[model samples]
Every structure is written in C-alpha cells, then in structure tokens.
Target chain A: MKKQRNLTMAITGFVMLLVLHGTAYGLSDVFKENIYVPEKLAPTDSVLKVAVGEKAPDFTLPSVHHGKISLSQFIGKKNVVISFVPAAWTPVCSDQWPGYNIVKDLFDENDAILLGITADNIPTLFAWTNQMGELWFPVLSDFWPHGGTASKYGVLRSDGTTERAIFVIDKKGYIRYIDVHNINKRPPLESIMSELKKLNQ
Target chain B: MKKYFVVVMGIVLCLVVSGSSLAFDTKPPAVGDVFPEITFSIPGESDYRTYLGLSKGEYFSIQDIKAKVVVVEVLSMYCPHCQREAPRVNQVYDLIEKDPSLRGKIKLIGIAAGNSTYEKKVFRERYGVPFPLFEDADFELHDILGGVRTPYFIGVRIDSGVPRVFYSKLGGFESADEFLRMMIELSGL
Candidate 1:
C-alpha cells in the first residue's frame, strides 16, 4: 500500500516540479525543505554480500541523465564508483547525490566515474533528482526487475528498499572498496574519493 | 485522472503539513536572541586564518574572532540558491573591505551545512567565495540552527562576550549594498 502511494506521489511530484521549473526560484535552490522525508527506519538492514577485491557484478540500467548505462562499459577505460542509494526524497539520499555535483572534478582528477543507482522507476527518480539540482553523472534505475542490481550487490533491504552503499570498482573491474552505510546517516563522498585516489596510486 | 489528481493533492497536503511542522519546530535565533557558541575549524589557509585573527588553533568560535559585527551565511555548495548568491556575497565582502568604517570592524563568513571539507573547497573554487566558510559535515550546526533552508543569513553583534543576533533571513539577497546597509544599521556599527 505504501509503495503504491509513493509511486503515485512520485508521478505527481515530477509533474509539479516540471511546472515549477520556470518560476523565479533558482533551479538549484528549488529542492530545499520541499521533499517529504519519512521518519528514520532501520539504520543498516541488509546483510553483506559483495566485498573488496571481488569482481563487481555488471548490469545495465536506464538513465534519465544518459540514455542507458552499464557497469561493464567502463571496464578498462575508467574506474567506476557505483552508488546505491536506498530511495529518493529521503533526507540523506537527497543530500548525498546532489553533494556529488561539486566533486565531479575529484572524480575526473582521479580518472574515476560515478553511477547513482536506485530501486525506483525512471520517472520517480527523475522527479526526485530533478529538484535536487543538476547531476553531472548518470543516475540509473533498477526498477523493472525491481532491485535486481541491488539484490546482486546484497544491499537490498528486507523492506524492498536498497541500502545506502557505495562500491568502488577499479578500472580492471575489481571492487576496491565497499561502504554499505547506515541508512539514517549520509556516507561521506570524500571516503569514496580517497578510495579512488588509492586506486590511481 | 481522478486517481492521479487525488495523489497530487495528497502530496501537496503533505508538503503543506511538513512545512507547517518545520516552521513550528524551528526556533532559530531571532533578533536580540543570544547566538549560540559554536566552534569552527580554523581555516587551513594562512590569510583566512589571519583575517579571523587566529594565530594558531584547530577551532575558533564566532566570539573568538576580532570583529564587532559578524555576518554568517548558512549555505550549502550543492544549493543552487547559494551558488547563485555566491558572487553577490563576494561583492559584499569587497564592499566591507573597501568601506573603511566597516573594514576590520565587520567580518563575513559562511557556514556550509552538510558539506564536506572537499565540497567546501570545491564551492570556494567554483564560486570564488573570498570569505572563510566552515564545514558542517555532520549537520550538527545545521540542526542547531533549526534546519532552516539554504542561503540563510544571520548578522551577529558580538559587543559583549556573547554574540547577539541582529538580522536573520532565508534566501538570496537581491542587492549587496542594500544588504550591507541593513546589516550595518541593524548591528549599529
């Protein structure tokens, strides 16, 4: 029931935000205090599945920022950082990805790329992320199969949501770092950047 | 269409309720209210540290600074509002420096709520923000400031040991000179 309601809200919210796009408020600032974040849930709900040094499971997902993105596409060219956020509109999730916008240089400097993944549908993710501001990296959805990618990563929570996690895959496709963070708190991007730096070193 | 409309109304209803609840709960420092004592990490940069009059220290509070009036811009690098207001903020800093009376008397600093150190640096580099911006990485300061929206500004008067709030508002200021004028008048400096 709650899931149905959220989908409903997500669609409407997207339309509403599109309507708000042309208003006087700066496009970037429109997201402040507007999202409906639910009360805190289990901090770390899922059991660990993937770990450091393992081959990261590759998957393809649709992206609004880009047409489609796959983990395997950057195997030899660029080190990849796959960020699996639990959901959109939640407090930490909203802050975390938008926070990545400023660190595009850090990612580029380290010759690394970032992919934001979620269990929500494309329209839902679009509605939620659009208000947060421009995201330089591609944001993909694992919705049709519904948490298929997150399940493979073992960060999918029991409640059908994914965990707040980050997986850093080296250019050679080996996982260098995995931080399946506490759901209630934000995982600092610097830690991920540090991992990127280490991979380059 | 009816179902979709109902859902939209429900979302709108929740937004209104949420805004109202936040308004009721957030009691940030008002005019004449005593500003809380919060320590900021001493800027690693030498000039900024000297500007704040901190010779050597890991942390310093607003009261520790030598200025009589302090303008605190509570912002986030990720906030487009703050990004847009960055140049105007820099202009205000320049004005303060050029104005002999305001110079050395009034100080401006930014508190980037929920931003990491690197994120703050990125914001500074991207926007050319001249003033020292302290990081509230854990959002401890943000929660203390009532979790107010970004681009919030507060003018503090530290005539005595404790800082007193003089001007507080949320969102971007239209004019830098007028904002500085208001800050000067309100701070009575």
Candidate 2:
C-alpha cells in the first residue's frame, strides 16, 4: 500500500508540472498590467545644455546588472545612444525600453551601444526593468547624484525628473544628434535610427 | 511530508496568479462575442494595403477587411514573448497562404500595444513579418478590445460583414500547424 501511495504521488507531481508548463511557467516572469499611471505633464520641461557637434560629457554610473560603466570606455570604439527617460513605471518609459529591446541588431549594425538612464535608483530600476523581459543594453542609474548626468546634459527638469530625450554620440565622443523630446511623448525610433546611420557614414 | 506540501502549494499559487493574468484581469474579448470596431491605419506600403483590400484611405475598420476570417494578434514589440512568438506566427501565415482553400478567405494582422509606427516598423523588419501591422502607441486599440496581455490572439469571422469572434486567448501557442488547424476549425472553414 505504501508503494502504491508513492507511485500515486509521483504521478500527481508529473501532472502538475505539465499543467504549470502549459499555463504559468515563464509567462509570469515579466511584468504585466496594473501599472500606476499619472496624469500628463508639460510637453518639454527642460532645456538642453549640450548641442549637436559639442563634446559629449563623460560620466561613470552604476548599472542595474553590470558594474560601474564609464562613458569614456566606448569613446573611441563604439557610438553611444544615451536615452534619458523621465521616470520608471510611467506610461512612455515602460514601453520605450522594451521597444529598444527588439532592435538590438539595428544598434549593433551602426556600431552603437545604447545606455538607458533615469533618475530612479538601483532597486527601483531593477524592479522596473525586471518586468521588461531581457534588455540587451546596460541600464545605468543616475540616482546617487539625483539626476546629476541629466543635469549635466541640461535634461533635468524643474521637478527633478529627466526629460524624455535622446543623445547620439559618435566614436570620438562628439554629440551627433540631440532630441530633447516632449516629455509627454516617446522619441520615434526612426529618428534615432536615422541619426545612428549618420554616425556610420 | 510538510516539504512536499509546500512545493505543491507554491505551484498552485503560481497557477492562480497566472490564470488571472491570462484573461480575467481586463475582461478581454472572448469567444461568441462581437469583436470591437478597430479602425486601423492603412499601411503606407502598397503590398500591405493590397493584402487588406484597402484602397486610398487613411484608415479602415474591421468590416473593411475583404476576408471571411481575420486573425488579429495583439502584440507589443517590447514584449519578449511576442518576439519569440513572431516566427511561429509567420509560419502560420505561410501555411494559410499555401493552402489554396484558406487563401483570400483568411488574413492576418497585428495590433501592437504601446508601439509607435517606427517601433512597429522595427519589429516588422526584425522579424521579417509578412502581414500588415498597425501601431497602438497610446494603448487605445488595446483598451478598446479589453486590455489583454501581449501575444493575444483573436480569430474573427466576417462572413456577413460583421466581425464575430470565434477564438480569443492570451499567451503563446505550441505549434504552428496545430495553431493554424485550430484557427481553421474554429472559423468553420
């Protein structure tokens, strides 16, 4: 009778595993609905201090998964795309990073590395990005100095949040394109790709 | 015995949570319901516009599609699951096209939640997607259809000019052939 019971338990376990695999496994690993959304804010809240053709500012920042990454590390090797999102969990920010996740090859084709920056700290960024599935690029935190890098580029808003912006820097550390986009909208991917193509040329 | 019980309980909890996310969270469109009227922008490409049988228009509604059955895929370019499901979906599209009986009778399109035109374009190019895809940059189309998760599939039959849904499910499918069979069977083709 004990042997029969053990067999029954083993069978039950196998069935449960199959059910989980079909319905639940890996599907829940990423974030889903139930995000807390806030009302719309000003279109473009900050002015950019950096301009096209200016030398891009170099900084060292902590990443969610990787250790400290410096802008100078890729200065002479790869073009860099600095994406400054306003906040985590908000409407545009959540979708923007995931969109970039799909086009890693495009960035690589142009010899560019994208660095996603926001004022939210490590834990916040970790929890936020954890739901975005697997991102291909390093997501750095500008939290310690409270939007310090954003301020350096003049993207820090009056309310301490960064502007939804894009800055494309060439291999020689010169700013090639700057789009301090409207805070309420995402900078279209075509514009970014167009700018990256210029760096390739 | 206690350890075994804990493991079982953990698995059960995961199912319960995942179940809610599957469909009930936002009351997604289900079988036997009238699919919402989604006015999609006609793709600028001539091939896509011709595939949908749309002519000279900024937008066209579901009723405008010239097919007996339309397969609508609600996806997000940012969604890893959607990215993984893209190839399988493309296979389904190919199988449907090769089957002469299903050709012109069935069509496939994608509605990308929170994806802009440019983002949607990148997804199409990256996946080599053959079907026409529309952007739902603000989630308007998603909310109208009941805010479901990515990789959601809805099979609608428009035989008599009104779209009546026959299949609606969240998450991904197992096999391309199996999925195509289901769509064909459910639409009564």
Candidate 3:
C-alpha cells in the first residue's frame, strides 16, 4: 500500500511540474496599438504634368524637422530623390517613409539625399511621422498652397493629395527618372536602387 | 498495480495538455499540411550555425535543416510592427537556446520580405537578432506563403525530409515562453 501511495505521489508531482511549467509562461500583455486614419472614397486619377529629361521645378517648403528646405539647395551639391506620398497618417504612406528610413546607407552610397514631400500641414506630418521612429531625411510639407510642389511636378491628385511618385534629379537639376505609381501600391525599393545606380554610372 | 496507475496517469496528462493546444486556428499551411520548400541565403558563418548547420558563406535550402521542428518568421525591414516585434522574437530564440530538449530539435529563421541584403543586415544589426535572417528582395517567399502580414510566424514539423506546417500566427506572439510552449505542443516535440 505504501509503494502504491508513493507511485501516486510521484505521478502527481510529475504532472504538477508539467502544469506549473506551462502556466509559468504567461501571454504577453503588450497588445499592438492600432492607428486611426480616414480611408479614401475613390481611386486617385493619375495626371502626369512633368516628364523625364526636363528640368525639375524647384520649390521651397516648410520641413517638419527644419524651418524650411529648398529643392535647389542640393542641386549643385548632391543628387536628390524626391518622394511624394498622398497624405499623412494613411496606411501606405505611413509604411513607405519608415521603409526608406532603414536604407539611409543606400542613399549615402550613391551620393544622394531623400526629400519626403506630402500635402499635409506641418503639425499633421509631425504627429504621423513621429510614429515611424527616427527618419534620416527631411519630411517637407507643401500645405500652405496645398500641394504646390507636388502640383509643379505634375503628381497632384484631384483630391488635393499627391500621387505616390518618385522623382530622381541629377546634380545638374535634370529629371532622370519619374515613377507615378498607384496610390494603393508601394513602389519597390529595387526600382529606386536601379535608378540611383544609373545616376552613379 | 502501481506501475499501471503511473502509466495511465501519464497518458491522461498527455492527452489533456495536447488537446488544449489544438483549439486555435491560423492561416494555411494549416496543421498537417506540407510546408513548401524554399531556398534562401544568409551572410557569415555565425548566422548559419543555429539554422542550416552549414559552414559560413554557404547557401541553404529548407530541406537542409536537420531539426525536427522549424520556426520561420516572415518580416519586412521597413515594417513598424516588425521593428517592434524584433526584441520579442529574439527572446523566443533565446528561450529555445536555453531549453535543453529544444536546443537541437528546434531552429528559428527569418525571411525579410521585400528587403534587400543591405537592408536585412541593417535590421539585424539594429535589433541585435542572433538568428539567421535571409532577404526576400523579390517577395518570392511572401507570394508562396499567401501574402501574410508582417511579423507572421510558421512552425513546421519535419518527418523524413518533408516538412508539415504545424503552427501559424499572423502577428507577433504574446510572449516567448508561451510561443515556445505552443510550438513544442503543436509539433508534439
């Protein structure tokens, strides 16, 4: 009877260990936070106002980090890649700039600087971009005139937001490549890297 | 009589534990479905040590892993959610390393969706991840895996060179210990 009791105790202890081991590891309490942004009712209409091989129209705009940034300031010094997103706090736009944030070395390797342009005001840009860690490039706002810089590049949508576009300008301020992508889709990084390679060559 | 009681009790405990873990459903290659075989490369010898068991600078395919259980993470360097989940994922890796029974039988790897080699390296360095991270620049792995969201996880059980998906989660797991336990329970390891 004592042997049977010991057996029962040993089995109970082993099962208890298993149960304790399982329960000791609790579920994480840090749930993912959701960011709220309004969705667009209609697809943006693409209208190309500028073409490659032409001189890029220069503009000065207020930056979220700095007081002001001028496109022509880097023309004689380094190549520039102007990234235009539709609006602030939206899903695709939020992910786009952060993706570029990790690739600062890629831009540095090709002797180029990235300028993120959006039609939203400074305060909105500040709140939206702060969610995306630290960004190495300047995020410029074209808010006062309502996408004036985006309009000059022919990427302004009818909804007052800019189309998802990329403009690669050479050191001499000539447009080398222009990609006006669908507002819903992300422009792949490989395409931009290849364009930058062309500029280096 | 005592031996019989011990055997019966152990069997009952096993059934109860495994039954509770099977209640959750996730995206495909659901439990028992064959995990697709994919090929990818990683830089340096250290990253390959715990993953493919290959020497430094050698490319490895899914079939090369000798472990009975494998965990694959589909992530993107530019994804904010993935960036936030990195440290937790690292903790899972550490848990697996520390556990004696799971050390050699289970392995963890990451596939960086839409990230280039340079970008993957930057993420690894920034997050201090010790697992082997591979670049899916063209998103071939992403397309093959049915376009799951960032920080997605897939756990597989290997049976004679054929991998069957045993566990899948869309987002980050709550905790490393819980995740490790789930993987072990689902894989029946």
Q: Find the candidate with the highest lDDT and give its number.
A: 2
Task: Compute the lDDT of residue A199 as modeled in candidate 1.
Answer: 91
Give the RMSD in angstroms, all C-alphas superposed, for model 3: 17.0
Across residues A64-151, which tens digit of lDDT does each residue of candidate 1 receive?
7798888899989999998888887665676677668767888999998989998999999999888766789999998879899999
Predicted structure with the largest DockQ when compared to the true one? 1
lDDT of 1 by residue, B1-189 (tens): 668667677777676554443334355678998887677888889999878878777888888888999999988876767877889999999999998878888999998887788878888988898889988877667756766678889999997778999988888889999999999898988
TM-score of chain B of each: 0.85, 0.85, 0.79
Interface RMSD of each: 10.0, 10.4, 12.6
What TM-score, computed on C-alpha atoms, does each candidate reach?
Answer: 0.80, 0.75, 0.66
Query: Tens digit of lDDT per residue, candidate 3, span A1-201?
Result: 777768677766665554333211001112123433343324457577778999999899999998799988998899999999988766567667887887788899999999999999999988888878778999999998988888888888888889888999999999999988867666877788889999988
Which residue pairs does candidate 3 place in steric collision? none
Candidate number with the higher lDDT (2 or 3): 2
Tens-place lDDT per residue, model 3, B49-107, is: 64567666556667578688889998877787788889999999898888887787888
Quote the lDDT for A34 in model 2.
45
Q: Output the better candidate (1/2) by DockQ.
A: 1
Error of 2 at A110 (Å): 2.5
Can you tell me which runs of candidate 2 are displaced by over 4 Å? A1-30, B1-30, B41-60, B114-117, B136-149
Off by over 4 Å in 3: A1-44, B1-50, B53-64, B87-101, B115-147, B158-188
Q: What is the C-alpha RMSD of each candidate to the true structure, in Å?
A: 10.8, 14.3, 17.0
User: Which structure among the candidates has the greatest TM-score?
Assistant: 1
Q: Is 1 or 3 the stronger prediction by lDDT?
A: 1
Scored against the true structure, residue A109 in model 1 reaches a CA lDDT of 94
